[model samples]
Target: MPSIRCCSSFALAAALAAPGLAAACSTCGCSLNSDWSSQGYATSLGWHLSLREDYFNQSQLRSGADSVSRSSFAYPADEEVQRKTINRNTLLGADYSFSRYWGLSLQLPYMDRHHQTIAEGDTGVSTSDARGIGDLRVLARYQGFSDDAGIGLQFGLKLPTGRFKQDFVSGPQAGELLDRGLQLGTGTTDALLGVYKFGYLTDSIGYFGQAMAQIALDAREHFRPGNSLNLNLGLRYLDAGRFTPQIQLNLHGEQRESGAQADRPNSGAVLAYLSPGIGVRITRRLDAFAFVQLPVYQHVNGLQLEPRRLWSLGLQYRL
Candidate 1:
């Protein structure tokens, strides 16, 4: 039998804060179970490292669960017109288990994002690209609830280690500071808490469930991201020997942005996705996985850009 650890991706913060310059859904992330997201969790107690890369493009305009045209947000008539947003995110994680009861994990994020938008009066498209480290998270886990450590709790802190003062370098918005939601970091410390449980329904069927919350501690320069929450459920076919086939349902919700610089009319959202993935063990110490996410339901507070699909690939090695 394989051990299904309760590990998840982190980005759980607030949405954009600006005069409608940034993107929406700060809660949008890879959302992978990712103990490596693969099968290399190493049931033993030791150090492990994992890396995963994800890509998504938000070119579709949506409002209140309905698709809208870009012309609906034209200049003068509206304060903003969004063009497109693209993201390629990479995550590095390290985990160490002290015993069956306790463990520690650290995660770091790097982002390559491009945004294009037009202000209310500006006719030209203003573009900006941000590439750098986003944030760092440190967490502790306790899985001593059962003899097999199938139930666990996770608590952590999101550090403000990334740059939030980047500026657009092209078009009419050149030299203007990038919106809070598009920057490399949120610029605010956040608290994270979550719980998870994993077990087997039968000898070949395994199931897991998790819920997490991320709340901002304070605002920075009159801008703050909203609080976010996530819920996940998954099942894996364990009969495949070296290969594990999996399916998951993920739910994400975020509050509206707050602060004078923030506009609530175009931010927060509630999104649900269906994710299916497969994992393969290449060696005893190495594993790989791939997954794709498609939105089953999406409702936003206001005008926002959302991806039609998201995909990711990952690798993990036990050291």
Candidate 2:
């Protein structure tokens, strides 16, 4: 039987922060599980490495789960517009165990993104593309509960390593600075806090729950990303030998951005996704996993482009 583990982090933190800040659309964040911490095979003092890739294409504009096909302009009196976006992320993560009760983790990501918009008033298409490294995250974790009923606490920081003020090299919006949300990074330092718990049921099934919070501590370029909260509830069936099937419910909510460059009207949202995944134990020291997230419900604040679906694939190896 496969071992049940509790591991999750902000693999998509940069993606979710981009909507309205940089692009005319919103992108889904891919929260990946960190299995090395809980699996019995990784109880010894050592280090673990992981590689993850996430993909999503968001093109449709919506308001509260309802599509917004066309909107009449109040000022122009005869204009309508449409927007779309695509984003991809590749992440490298590392975790080290200092003792049974303590550990540390870091994540670095690279991103490629495209944005496009068409308006009735303008015949030309407005498009932009950006590719580079995203932000960086470092976290410290403490496992303070019993072996059976485990509880973990995490605290971390997000560094502004990704480019924030990218300009359109060529396009209808050429030489113009992209939206702060559309940049590779927020150019802000953020504080991350999280708590998680896991346990088994009937020796064959297991369950876990986690909650994470992100708050921007400082801003750059007259812009600041919004504060956000994330919640995840998951069930793992461990009786399937080397193959483990899992299901997760993920919920995310964010407050609107604040500052001079903020896009208040098109910011903020509450989104819930149903994620189905499977894990394969390739060896005692390596594992592979994949997951797909489908939006079950969404209540966006304004007319913003939202993701139709999100997918991720990853590998973890003990080092």
Candidate 3:
């Protein structure tokens, strides 16, 4: 029993699926499309709930696509020299939908993070602050081919529960640790795959697309983490009054990191973003959303640290 125009564009496209600072590179963390938009549209059924938030700040310093300066990262630059990272992300979702195809979903994340770095010749400037929970996803979907289901397919897992050997509580690497791509969890276990589609080109417009992947599976202590992909494409505007407007383009990529506590050349990247949003219904079951993700292309693979804009907000319910 899903209506209100199919969960209002998946609760405003999950506000671009924030997902916290999923590791600073290696394709980076979440770019949206968590379990098919996280809150709705698995093609009608039952149960639903969602909550999301995502913020970003990564202080410039690029490489593959230019922008790199910060006193050459340090002295005689042998690398190492990151300065700033502040991300806040919280996501919580739950869904059922055992009909119209199939469905099951769960996502929970939390991360506060803060960091600063400088080393390779040392010049002070080393810090860290960690927060709780991260990593934990579970998904499943299928959209009976036709029957107005609009196509779908997804699968998931990504559990490692969160918290992985964190360290560096303050200053000059106080207590060391930190950096397995910026901990908070990456302790292995990962696998997810995806596909999605939506329709309608008129009648008030509608569109959607998705792709996902994560990989990993095992490798901890000696580090592994790397392997990612995310893609989203959206458009929505259906009016029946109650506001609704959307836009999206998102994209992501990754592949790097390996044994020996990797950092394999600053991980990996190939980002892109452009989200824009609005959504509200607040009735017939509730809904609300917001987004703004700007990046429009980045390249990374060396220096790292990026983030010029990113913001998200969300809420959804139907139970």
Which candidate ranks first by TM-score, i.e. highest?
1
- Higher-TM-score candidate of 1 and 2: 1
Residue 242 Cα positional deviation in candidate 2, in Å, after optimal superposition: 1.6
Give per-residue CA lDDT, model 3, range 219-265, as digits (tens): 88888777776778788788657777878788877777788877787
Arrange candidates by TM-score, descending. Answer: 1, 2, 3
Return whichever of 1 and 3 wins on lDDT. 1
lDDT of 2: 0.69
User: Which tens-of-lDDT digit does each residue in 30-98 have in candidate 2?
Assistant: 544444443322345678888988898887688766877645444232332436778788888888888
Per-candidate Cα lDDT values, in order, are 0.71, 0.69, 0.71
TM-score of 2: 0.87
Candidate 1 segments whose C-alpha is farther than 4 A from its true place: 1-22, 25-28, 36-43
Model 1: per-residue Cα lDDT over 1-319, one tens digit each: 2444222121111111111123553344565557521122333588878788989898887888988887555455456667788889998888887876677788888889888888667988888999999778887777776677767777888888889899988989899987777788878888888787776788787777777788888888898778878788888777777777888887887888888767667878888889988877777677788889899998887777888998988887777
